[model samples]
Target chain A: MKTILSVENLIKKYKNFKAVDDLSFDVKKGEILGLLGPNGSGKSTTINCILSLLKFESGKITIFGCEMRPDAYDIKKDIGVVFQEVAVFEELNVIDNIDYFCGLYIKDKEYRKKCIDDAIKLVGLEDFKKFYPKQLSGGLLRRLNIACGIAHKPKLVFLDEPTVAVDPQSRNNILDGIKKLRDNGATIIYTTHYMEEVEILCDRVIIIDKGKIIASGTGDELKELSKIEEKVTVEIDSLDEKILEEIKQFKNVDEATYNNGILFITYKKGKNNLSSLIDYLKKVDVHYDKIYSERPTLNDVFLYLTGKELRD
Target chain B: MFLHNLKYSLKTLFKNKMLIFWTYAFPLILGTFFYLAFSNIENSEKLDIIDIAIVDNEEFNNSIALKESFRNLSGENEQEQLFNIKYVDLAEAKTLLENDEIAGYLLVEDSPKVIVKTSGINETILKYVTEEIIQNEDVLTNIIEEKLNSTVIDGSIEEFIQNVREDAISMLDTSSLQIRDITSKKLSYTMIEFYTLIAMTALYGGIIGMTAINQNLANMSNNGKRIAVSPTNRIKIIFSSLLSSFIVQIIGLFILFMYTVFALKVDYGNNFPMIILLSLTGSLAGLSLGLAVGTIFKINENLKTGIIIAFTMLGSFLSGMMGITMKYIIDTNAPIVNKLNPVNMITDGFYSLYYYTTYNRFYFNIISLLIFSLIMIILSVLALRRQKYDSI
Candidate 1:
């Protein structure tokens, strides 16, 4: 795949603090690249540096095989940025707002109108064409913001936590619309702290912490990097410390803990881990409600890699 | 592209009702209040007639010229009369002065003298009249002395005295002080208040300019961030936004000028075209000042707005927006401040239009305003040249 954006050795400093420290990444064409990080992990700073909206102490950014600068209007013409904060004009109605932002790129009036209409329909704002930003709810406003940003149908789009503070329904609508954009042949750089969103949409994920990329791979590959192979959870009416110690002594059991009415067990690597736990429960005559075993998810991988949850 | 950006900016600004209220409606409302407050003051003060007591004595009778001057001053037409003269005894005249019933009294002895209880406008006029009478008498005495020594006279003493009285009265009528009254322009003090109010309105365009800057600078707002990342040149965006703000502000100023001139009946001179031109230039200066301040600072929008408003108020205050005498006070004490202040320049431009027949002062003010605006625009563009922000 062709590289749409590449940043090499990008360093952005704020006085004594380095916001983006020697960050290097590339986003390929026609793929959704997820930049997952906690707050203040330099995701926004890095994106801004790539867009030339920020000044870096040292860096090189290239878009479409051309060096990017503040005045690189040709490269910027094909780029769209949807900020984490909704950035639509409050005084302008939905249609006019989208048209205005689209006009910034597509100057041809008739074509721009069609693009604006398509964007509005894509964001499911057909009923709110004449409604001002203040008149719309938070969810509908976020949709309008999305429509405004992507109205020009740029080939490269950066969606920076676009679903932050949005309702579940609107979040799903936005995600679906973003997927449609990707399927329509637009490369996307999606930034977020939600692991599930990356799992659902991103083709490749890069997890960053403290201005450095800690891990980058496909979802299954990241999961394989974690030490935990499986997690077995059991709900029991009563459990004794002797059984819990014996369960911990199992050859594949890495850790076991009993709290309240549930028994939790993590395995390093094991086959039939659930069956082994069930057999031990029966032997100890512990009455149980239910038991299940699941493979390690991206959340476990994130925690194992960074010692912090994605939401944290 | 410029027109396109300007079109959307204009639409957005017009839709901002709060900006509309502050820029247009508020000035009109305040102007109405000023009209109501000061309309009757000039008319009520016009009815006052100076009261003076003249001592009735033989010395007053001996000086026929002084008595005739006093008689002529008390004419049949009340509008023509300079004083309401009361012939009374010396004790009574002193009593009138003590009781504050008369401004002063005249003692027509060999050398005429005037007395008053305290100093005031009426007292000052009375003194001028008395001094003129004494000076004329001295001139007549000197002329008679010179004529008697030079040649013999054929006319009677009474006829000579009458002739001298007529000559003295004519000389008094043709004096520079009387010419000042004949050619005194109709000056309305309330007009200054209206001019300063318009100045304040012109400076209020700064708010619109600040809005433009806030909407265009990358670090100022989220909308700014989006625009900053767009393909358009930053200068183009700044220019278009300022042009849109200027268009809106000029329209607001025009409406305000029309309301003040027609509805409030403010005499902003007969030079309508010049007035409109000054309004446009003044509004531009105000807008440029706002743009410069907004671009130079990395503060929040509210703080920038506060700074703009406070600066405008300071300028207006120095230009006599609060009172008619403040402009004069500042001009007298700190003339450089008045010369540099944009609000003062705007008010003075309007004042020169109405008060002067020549456009020299008016054009000077206009040129000053243009220079001020140019400096602000240049500074704003320089400050905005940093397209990439260290932080947003």
Candidate 2:
């Protein structure tokens, strides 16, 4: 895939604080690039610098093989940005807000209206065409914000935390709308703190911490960074400390903890770790309610690499 | 693109309840209070003929010179009467003064004395005239003696008294004093307050200008950031937004003119076209100030609002909104301040229409307002030239 956007040695500072420190990355064509980070990370700042909304100390940003400057309207025309904070006008209804933003890019009235309708449908706001932003709920307002940004149907779109503080249904709706944008031959740069969203929606993920890219790859590739292959949880009424030690002694059991009717264990790159633990529990006469095993999640991988939870 | 931005910008601005209130409702309410406060003020300016009395004492009755001087000055010769004197005793004279039927009374003492109950323009004029007569007593007496000797014997020598009165008037001219003194063709100082009120209404359009510019600046709002990142021209966005703000301002200006003219019955003179020109120019000055304020700093909406109000009220204050004398004082002390202040420019423009016979002063104010607006807009455009900012 061709590179649609590229940033080299991007450094943005605020007073003495380095908001983006020597950041370099590329967004490939038609790919959903997830910029995953915790709160206060440089995700939003990076996007702002790329959009030329903030002045960076030193950087080279290129879009569509052309250098991006503040007055580079030719490059800006094919780009869309949805800020982390909602940017829709409180006075305008849903349709007007969408039309206003869409008109900035598409001048033809009929085509613009169609694009606005498509954006509204994509965000699942068909029934809320006339509702003002203040009248909408937090989730609906978030959807409206997204609709305003992408209504122009630019070739490249930047969605910064579009699903923050939304319900599961709305989050799913937003993620699906993003996917539709990608399917409609648009490249997406999605930034969020939600790891599950990155895992579910990102084709290529770049995890940032403290204004630096700590890891960048596919979800599976990044998960492989963790040595622990599997995680198991067993539900039991109670377990003795010595019996938990015996379960730890089982092959490939790296860590084990038993608390209040549930037993948790992690395995380091070994097969049949769950069954082996179940066999040890049976031999110890430890009656369990249930047992399950699953792969290490992105948070677990992040914890392994950074010594902190992904959310922290 | 300009029309599209302008259309939606109008919708957005007009829909905002707070903006409409500041730009229209608040000014109209304040204007109503202004009209009520100053509605009767012009009526109080007309000076009426003063009614006075002469004390009928032995000194006044026995002296032919004093009697003839008083009689001739009191319209005995059919000249424009300065006073209508009643020959009353001392008690009756005091009674008339106490009852407010007379402005004051004159006593024929060794060195003639004038007395009044309270101080006013009429009272001051009477006292000044009495002093003038005392200073020129010898000239008047000689003139009266000359008239008396030359005229033939007649019971009523009115022409002789008329000649004496004419000689006295040459020594002390007091022909044009009235209750409501309008010496300069309907040019009343009370109208300055209304002119400044109109000026204030025009400049309050600054709030509208600020609101319009706030919608498109990157540091001011998220809508601004969105517009900043779009492919459209930033200058065009700002121009159209200001254009919309101007339309709203004109609507507000029109309504205020109607309310002041038709409702409050303010006589704004016959220079209707010049009035419109000054109003539109003043509104532009206000709008440009808003544009400058919105772009020159990264301040929040509330702070920007405070700035516009502070500057506006300060300008209004110096332009004589509180009192017409303040504008006179400022013009006397610091002519450049009113020259720079847009509010003063507007009020001064209206004043030229009321006070001056020519349009020269009015044209100067209009040009000053336009230049002020142009400077603000140029500064705003310079500030807005940078597509990116150090901080949002």
Candidate 3:
């Protein structure tokens, strides 16, 4: 498929700080591209640059092979942006707000009415058509936000944490709606800090840090780049000093820790590592609780790449 | 796209009913208050009579005609004509003046003079009317002297009368000698017309406030942002706003006119068309000023408040609340600046009623008002052109 959006060597700088430095990516048609990053990792800045809402210092951005500016109406017509913060006319009702935004692109009143109805139905907001923004619940507002952005059926949709504070049901509904858009041959740039969401929805993921893409691949492909393979846990009553030493000396064992009568072991790279750990545990004759073994999740991959710490 | 934006704009305006009520309803309410206040002033009494005491120094020795004229001043059919005379003696007249029953006493002597207990009343008219009556005797003496010229002999009595005639003529010609010059009565005008003019101004100004806030809020919404990003330029946006404001203001002005003419019984003179023309110009000027202010300010909460206060002050000041004399001062001292002020044009439009019976300045003020509106709208467009919404 052809690329719907392409940015080359995008560099955005403040007075003395670099917000987006040497960042580059392409969004192909009919694909859900996940832009996963921690807070303040220049994810919002990058989205803003693509939308032409902010000017970058040195970069080339082409939306449908045209330069974006104040008069770039044609290019903007095929793009839909739903910001993290809900921006809607508080004075207008749900149907009116959707109609207003849709009216921007579609001038014919007859067609606009049909589009408005379709949008309301798509977002499951038919019951609250006459309700004002302030009267709606957080979930309903999020859905309304989506409906407003996508009412015109743009070819490319940018969702910036669209489900940041929504309930589980609303989150599922939003995810399903986004998938439907991609299924209908529209490119989507989905940004979120939630790793599980990225793994579930994105056809391809690009993990970013410090305004640079650290890794880019599918879920399994990203897992292969991680330094640790498997993690095994053992519920033990008491760990002897000698057993701890022997476990540390085992081959492929990178680190071991014990807390709350559970001894966790991390293997550098091994498939039979969990069985070896269980055999060692059995030979030790240590009383324990339940034990389990699991492969590395996306969160572990993120921690290993960006370090295990919270950032602003 | 332009109509689409306007449709959503009006929808947004109506959806915020509380804002609508405050913007439109408050002005109408305040206009009603002004109408009532001005109507009260219009219905007030004018041209009241002044109280005075009459002192007859010659008792009943006066001529019958003189006695009748004096008695006529006492306010009775049998003895009433000029003044509400008390017909008191000198002592009683003094006592009456002291008791405050009369403002002063008229002394009918060889030369008329007024004696007052104090200088409490407007003595200008009193002195003027008193001297005017005495001057008429000189004119009669001139006629009598001319009759003496037809005398058969040139005796001392004829010479004496002739000498009196010459003396009267000379006395009338002297600059220092005071004459009794009768003051002409003024026609009483109903206060309703003045109240109507005032009501028109207040309503016009109030509508301006409403439209200014409307445009300000229109530019504040997301739809407003979306419109800016559309192919329709800033000029079209301003044009649409001005058109909307103009239509609404005209409706309000029409309602105010009906209320004043039919309900309040205000006769806007025979030049009804001219009055309407002035009203239209005034309202447009006000509307333009409102829109300009809205366009110039940042689209935020405080714009409405600021525009309302500024439009009100400017409109009232130019609408002649600064008084007619001040208007003349401004017009004469700074014609260019005064011409540029829309409120001044509106105020002058009302004043045109009194000067030119046929509405001479009607076209002049309308054109000036239109020009003022155009300038304001141009400024607003320029201001909006510089606006670029980079982010929140």
The numbered model that scores best in DockQ is 2
Per-residue alpha-carbon lDDT of candidate 1 for residues B43-151, written as tens digits (9 for 90 to 100):
6754566789999899998885578667766666666667788999999999999999999999877667788887654675567556545655666567666654443
Task: Give lDDT for model 2.
Answer: 0.83
TM-score of each: 0.82, 0.81, 0.67
Docking quality of model 1: it rates as: medium
TM-score of chain A of each: 0.95, 0.97, 0.91
Per-candidate iRMS values, in order, are 0.7, 0.9, 3.6
| Predicted structure 1: clash tally | 0
Clashing pairs in 1: none
Worst 10 residues of 1 chain B by lDDT: B176-185
Clashes of 3: 11
Error of 1 at B62 (Å): 33
Give per-residue lDDT, candidate 3, residue A262.
76
Query: What RMSD does each model have against the real structure?
Result: 9.7, 10.4, 12.5
Residue B355, candidate 3: C-alpha displacement in angstroms: 6.4
Error of 3 at A133 (Å): 2.6
Using lDDT as the yardstick, the better of models 1 and 2 is: 1
